[model samples]
Target: MTFLLGAASALQLPAYQALVPEIVPRKSITDAAALSSVGVNLARAVGPALAGLVIARLGVPFVFAANALSFALFLIVLLAWRGYQRPDTRVEPFIDATRAGIRYILHAGVVRRVLVQLACVMVPANALWALLPLIAAGPLRLSSSGYGLLLAAVGLGSVGGAFLMPAIRTRLGIGGTVAVASVIFGATSIALVLVPSLPVALAVLIVGGVAWIGVVTTLNGTVQSFLPAWVRSRGLAVYQLVLFGSTAVGSALAGAASSLFGVLPVMVAAGALTAVSAVLLAARPFPSLTGRDRAPMPSTDVPPVTEHDPALQGDVLVLVRWQVAAGHVRAFLTSMDALGHSRRRTGAREWTLHRDRDHPDTWAEVFRVGSWQEHIDQQTVRRTGDDAGIFSAVREHASDDPDIEYLITPDRTETPHV
Candidate 1:
């Protein structure tokens, strides 16, 4: 029962996280993310102390009951929220959708880079959060209250950092801010190991908390910025999977290392790794969000098959034939290569660029989608404003506008569109 409840709770997390991008304006997405972090940190600061008090006054059963009731209240509030409406979309089979989402992230350069950087920083950074209680009890010889105070200090620092994020981002930019934060946190981790004094440790934790919030919030915003509405939930699910997976693995490893060696030695090693990762990642900074990354542009083209239900239709094939001048062939091919990445990232199952054997000037771009509905969704919601520029560039190289053809399987079974 406990495992099932936990699993159910975890399933809703991505949807809740994805809601922030949907509710807020694109321009203020970074600030909104910061605000969300602030709420989490604020809860971290308050919830524990409140829970302790409740546990002392009441019993463990009462505390658990209260927790269940709180969730019930949350459900009530969620159901009452009628402002945001989800876009109408045909749901794909779970496994196929999951594969498509994974494919899109793997193909997209910016999304891939963000996930890699997040893992690099988060793995080592998790040491402090996961092992701090053990350190407080064993090494520092602090009481439970003292440890709570230390956590409170960290939470306060996170709140401050959240409030200051916009200014820091404006001055330093996202990459610079993350790099500085990582270094600061790494240094603080080392300091926590060295410094035995409680007051000093609290100060170090405050700095560490600020740095933690900065890196996490920035990474969150970066991921949210790049994802389109169609794939936002799935993409975020993958991001959260990486995040929690890394933390779990890091914590387990850190625990083993601490047991083998000592807490201080393990912490110092983690700190060093974190600092090095920050420097290495800073060299290949995360891509900044342009105006184009804010939202996907809707395509003007109508769906090819009006007679058939898109959901029932199987594998879509799209071919575009471009007439290129002999002199522009090389340049056109170069542009097409870049465009191909965009195509694959935006739900194309298979993409290929072909040159005509008979007429060397003629070029063909072919791609496939899983279904007609998938193709429609890909055309309408998967495309970004930047894609328009790419298409325009390709058209510029062509003597005339490119000809497009859509093909589907003949044996299409009619199923009810959900």
Candidate 2:
């Protein structure tokens, strides 16, 4: 199953990238977002029918085999594509780095809120995905063609929702937006089960799809926006783990309920759980929230984000995908401070400032410039003069992220990182 997803990623990302020239997104990131949205839309449209056909005609083992073959093909295609690198020139203290990530998630109110919002809808969502086809084929008594049409309707609705997410998020804030989306999801889930006919059920499912994609996209943006640069990858990994981990549990429960009661019962359970999750999340706000509901605190176990040493030099490399700080304490701080000051001074592009909630002193500024070298070249830094004398004062902190390397984007799938 995992291999098939990997294979899809290899073939699909590039194939979609080819469509970039046509979409002409408002921003580069938005283009990436659009392609991702559309690509998922395409696959979601096909996945149900494909699964139904394989299970109905070919059998479950064949479905599994097909998935494996897809993964193998994706692996071959990905290997054929160039410029994927994971080797590092040096290594550093990783355990402390892992601790730093955990501490921030535990402490950062904003990150917690985002994670909570995702969880609220996601837990019940797994049930919806699991039971949708079963209900369509069972009492719904829809033929294979009808099921395929229903899947297409859901896919179309999701794509529409993705297009609307940015604007809706802008208006509601992540907190309010997610809260509202959760309501829509729960209500739609119930509606899908209650509908008297296939067409009506199809419409409700489409609405559910819209709610699902919009809430998810908005939540993802919220998570990324709130995370500190030093722990962005790790923070995201944690989010994925929780969301997907709950999904697995949801799917399993859906299967059990379907066997014991019926598909409608499983679908109803999803809706009820979704409603409950919304209420719980609104009250508790896991993963935490920022702004008025957020705070910055001091923790003693890790160094603060603002630390600096006089001896650091050019070896200070910004970590890449899953790449963590293996460098010195003082050096990392100095580099981070320099990056923050540089970004603030230039006013050339948008950059976020995040100090660790626990280690307020160990500063780690977060920003995504045009390229990785944007930090080293400090293009805007040359304009600020802050980058000028800082190195001389802080060479003692200099060290490299041995994990630094260029990477190509891949398909979205379960990334199993503990």
Candidate 3:
């Protein structure tokens, strides 16, 4: 049952998140993300209490029946809803689309950093959830209802935190918000063990809840903002993979360590590690996303070749020659590094920069796309304002406009040497 539930969530989460940007305006995405969190936490606050009452008055079977009924209603609502209007763009094959998504993340430094930050916090933060039942049973010696109340407190606190997020984000920014929230959660974890009084633990959990929502909502929103529409769902799927994978690993480690070292020591270590991670994160914050345009602008010019053209069907290799200005080789290389990533992140299957052995000032930028169609898409469909800026910066170091060439292997012929 647990495995089945996990599989269901694996499908449900990414699809739900992908719909947010489609339904809401770009500026309201952060708020919409927070409201999604608010809904989950609100359910957390109410579900268990209701479940307990139903079990007490009716039975466990009745509680399950109610859950099934909720899902039925959800299906009905989904059936009635009209979906968002997507652009009439060419859709890649499923395998190709999946590969493109993976490639984007591989080349996107900002997204990688966000994922790393999330993992660092999530791995340790999971200790609270993994060990809370143990804490309730042993340290606090609470009854079932009391434990439910503790869960309710965390849920209620998260709901409150959602309302406070815009102000918090405005004040602290993404990095500071994550750092401070990490510290708060770490402190709460430490307090949960050291101060085992039921009342005190409940209070601490409330604070932990606030910190939890803050970190999650901020990071999730950051991912959503950074990802382009073409790969948003895939990126979120990867984010969810990291989030849940880290939780599983953390919970197992916490459980094992708690058995050997005792729950108190294990909790303390997790808390301390979480706080230390916060310090490390603050020292090296994520890159800012402000003022960057991610909207796709398709190329206006039509390609001469049709789909039936053999060259259009084969791999497309693009080569750009650059004559770097005197004494600007180093600066030029630095800018090209950014440009290379942009190429791969946009659509290039491979990208490389090479210098002419004979001519120190001359350089070559080489990239390949799956097909001519994809290369055409790279020109503007996958291009963004940020990519244009990078392109402009690279050009500033060049002595003259670089030469460009496109080549495609014929269907029955070998790839031609340059």
Candidate 4:
């Protein structure tokens, strides 16, 4: 409940979403990117600890009530707000283009093993939420001091997990390493609950923490293996929601039920829940699509690319080239990830971020508007704002040269499949 209040306020704060209107009003793709960013920044600034402290120091009830009052303020302001007319960039393309990549990493198999293993491990290990603290205070007879120490061990282990993943994988083989780590975490949590002494419990928790790192690093590296450049952020966010949020809720519920009963009963219950989750995951559809399978694999043997199809054209077929600034290549393409939102405002058929893979620092954003005039207007407005950092802040920048090539060739491609 307390956590929800903080999350809501962080997202709802007027100071944050105000950035949205700026970009949306200008038919710029940069608004959603900037606005989501502002909200995130504000949360970071007011360190939630202070807010949580303030809530706790005050009456918890009042804290929640005041949060509600603040939300009312946000809604009142929003109700009065007017949005700009969305620009339309609809176009009949000479090429149908939504160029995304599906290149898999060399260690793709190992990384996949890690992703599945972590998801499986998370289903069980996370259930300690309702049970662990109770065990710490009740079974281990630890004061808050010992609990804090235990938390530190976990934090340290997570940091180590980030750095030690590759070495761990090489030593254990991906599947063996993750499986061993998962067992340790699960067994350690159970041991922590059963152990009678605070010192013993703490030792188990430190071991658990070390294993936890192995779990986290394996999962993180696995995700990086096949993420498309365009939807990278969204994909990560969705993974967090499904993998973290679902597991967290499942754990909390199990822990609460176990607390109401006995620790042994709760452990048994958690194990059963994990077994069920494992079955469900294994039964899900297509657990094995790699990047190479879904995308057009560019290879040396593929005769000098010659696709003239409009709707089926890949990204490379749209714009020939562009220049960008140094050090802004990643950021430039990242900003283009907001293309869908920008497309709505500007009525663009497509908003594209093109990057040179050979020199990752090179990139450009290509806008396809229905009418060439809207395209011209977008350029004129941004070119003027180029000096104000208005375009820089909201418009995509490039470490490579940032330029647009408006194709003048008449549409000649035959109609594709309906």
Candidate 5:
């Protein structure tokens, strides 16, 4: 039952998270992202104290029964939501889709940077949340209700932070917000280590909570902003994977370190590491998303396909031939390099660039996709409005419009029915 509940909780997270950007307008995404944290923080503030009271009065079994009923109510509410409709479009096979999602994240520079920062910040910052109960029991010598109160303090602080996030973000920008939040969180961690009394620790937690919400909401919004709708769900899945994975690992490591070296030393080390990481990451801050980044750039120029063409056709090859002046070869190649990333991130496989030996000014860019339909999806949905500059750069260096060709190998195994 425990395993079932855990799995259900994990599965529901990505689904709800993926729906946020789709439901909210693009202009208000940052605000929506911050407000989403508000809901979670509100729950944190209320749920624990309520749960403790219920457990005290009603017993563990009754609490579990109530939890099940709450889940059922949640399901009913989800079913009644009428805002979203899934499009009737062909999807790639599960394995292929997974591979493409991974490929996209690996190639996208901004996504990679965001993930790195998330991992660095989370690994150290999680110690406070994971070890607070231990601290209350060991150092502050608090009862269970006192520990619950400490948690409620953090939650209340988070709620306040969420309300304040928009103003903070407008003043500081995403990178600056994350940097400031990291430093604050690190400082709070150190303060928690030094503080002895229950009241002092609770005060530190409130500050820590604000910093926590600031960092997380900024990171979440940035990731959503960088991704187009086509890959948004998959990209967010990867983001959640990293966020949860790092926190879990960090908690375990912190626990072990505390056991060996004592709690204060481990926390001090973690806090210092988080602060240093913020400085290093801020040096090459994550890129902000422009309006173009959020809008899709569906191609209007893909050649018409007949019904005879199979959706599962293997390895559709694309060749783009460009004619550049001798002086422009370097510039053309540089632009093509950027274009290549766009292609790969969109689902292209086996991408390559080649120069003609006989005609020094002629260059050919080549790539393959798994199927004809996949290529069409790449043309229609995978490209983003941000790619216009990349396309224009390549065109600027070309003598004329580049020639494009699509090819596929014949499948010999199929025989038409007589």
Candidate 6:
């Protein structure tokens, strides 16, 4: 049942998060995300108390029935709303779409950076969740209701933090906010081990909640802001994957370490590492919102295709020949490195830059796509303002227009010898 519930949640989270952009203005995306989080934390705060009351009065079965009824009510609300109309576009096969999403994450530096930062913080931060009950029962000597109160404190803090988010983000920016939040949460974790007083612990958790909501909302908002529309749902799906996957792995590790050395030692060590990670990760700060442009770039023309056209069916190899200006070879190479990532992120299966063996001034930039249709998608819907900027940078280093060629395999059965 738990696994089934997790699978359902995994499916729902991406769709839910992606809808925020459609419903809210781009400038207000972060604020909207914070408000959405306010609702979630509110539930986290109130749901337990309500459930406990129901369980006492009507039994556990009634709690489950109420949960089911709430879902039914949510579905009814969803059904009543008119949905957004999206532009009509050709849909790729499911397998191909999955491949594209994976490629994007592997090659897009911005997305990769966000995911790395999330994992770094979440792996250590998960220690709090994994061992909090143990801390309450052992050192703090708290009853079950007392433990619930501690959780309620965190939830209350999250609700309060959402109200303060706008001012906090304006003052701190994403990177500074993340760093400060990490330090605060880390300090709270360490306090858990050192202080052990119920009142002090509740206060610490409330403060920690403020920090938690800030980091989560900031990183999540960054993902939403940076990803282009075509890949937004996929990007959010990957974000959800990293967030939950990190927690699962971290929780397992924390539990094992606690068993070996005890919860207090693990808590202290997790806290220290969380604080240290903030320092290391701060070196590569997230790019500001002003810099990211997710608007679609003007589409390049693709060769016309018919139902029987072989051009539409085959793997594609794109080769671009460039002659670098004498002293600009180094600069050209650097620009190509950035462009290579853009190519792979969009659709390229493999990308490489090769200089002519005898003439170092001549360079060949080559990339392969799984199919012609996929390559066309890259030229059209997949290209974004970020890609346009990278292309412009590369063009600045070139002496003249690049020589381009598109080669497709005529037959699938024939294998080429290298």
RMSD of candidate 6 to true structure, Å: 3.1
What are the clashing pairs of model 6?
none
lDDT order, best first, reads 6, 3, 5, 1, 2, 4
Where is the poorest 10-residue window by lDDT in model 2?
293-302
* All candidates: TM-score: 0.92, 0.55, 0.91, 0.45, 0.93, 0.92
TM-score: the better of candidates 1 and 5 = 5
Which candidate, 4 or 6, would have the higher lDDT against the true structure? 6
Per-model lDDT = 0.82, 0.57, 0.85, 0.48, 0.83, 0.86
Model 2 residue runs over 4 Å out of place are: 1-35, 46-96, 281-418
Q: What's the lDDT for candidate 4? A: 0.48
Q: For all candidates, what are the clash counts?
A: 0, 35, 0, 21, 0, 0
Model 6 lDDT per residue over 1-418, tens place: 9999989998889978987888888888888999999999988888887888899999999999989999999899878778876633468789988888999999887789889989998999999999999999999999998898899989988988888888999998888888888899889899988998999999999999999998899889888877777788889999999999999988999999999999988999999877777885668877556867787775442233323355357888999888887899888888899999999989999999998989878899999998887776787778888887888888888887788888886876667678
* Model 1: worst 10 consecutive residues (lDDT sum): 299-308
Which ten-residue region of model 4 has the weakest summed lDDT?
98-107
Could you give candidate 5's per-residue lDDT for residues 102-172 as a string of tens digits? 98998899899989999999999888877888888888898988888888888878888988888998898
The collision pairs in model 5 are: none
Cα lDDT tens digits, model 1, 1-418, are 9899868857887788778877887767778888988988888788887888899999788888998898899889889999978855567799978888998898877889878888998899889888899889986898988898889989988999998888998999888888888899899999998988888998999888889889888888878867777788888888888888889988998998888998898899899888777776657867656555435676653324333483456788999898999988888988898789888877788999998999988889999988877777777667777776777777777888778898886664557469
Give per-residue CA lDDT, model 2, range 25-104, as digits (tens). 22333324534776778887878667987799989999988877987896797687565443221122466345545655
Sorting all predicted structures by TM-score, with the top scorer first, yields 5, 1, 6, 3, 2, 4
Task: Please report the candidate that would top TM-score against the real structure.
Answer: 5
Model 3, 216-303: lDDT tens digits are 9998988887888878888999999999899999999999989999999989989988877787676777887888878875533223
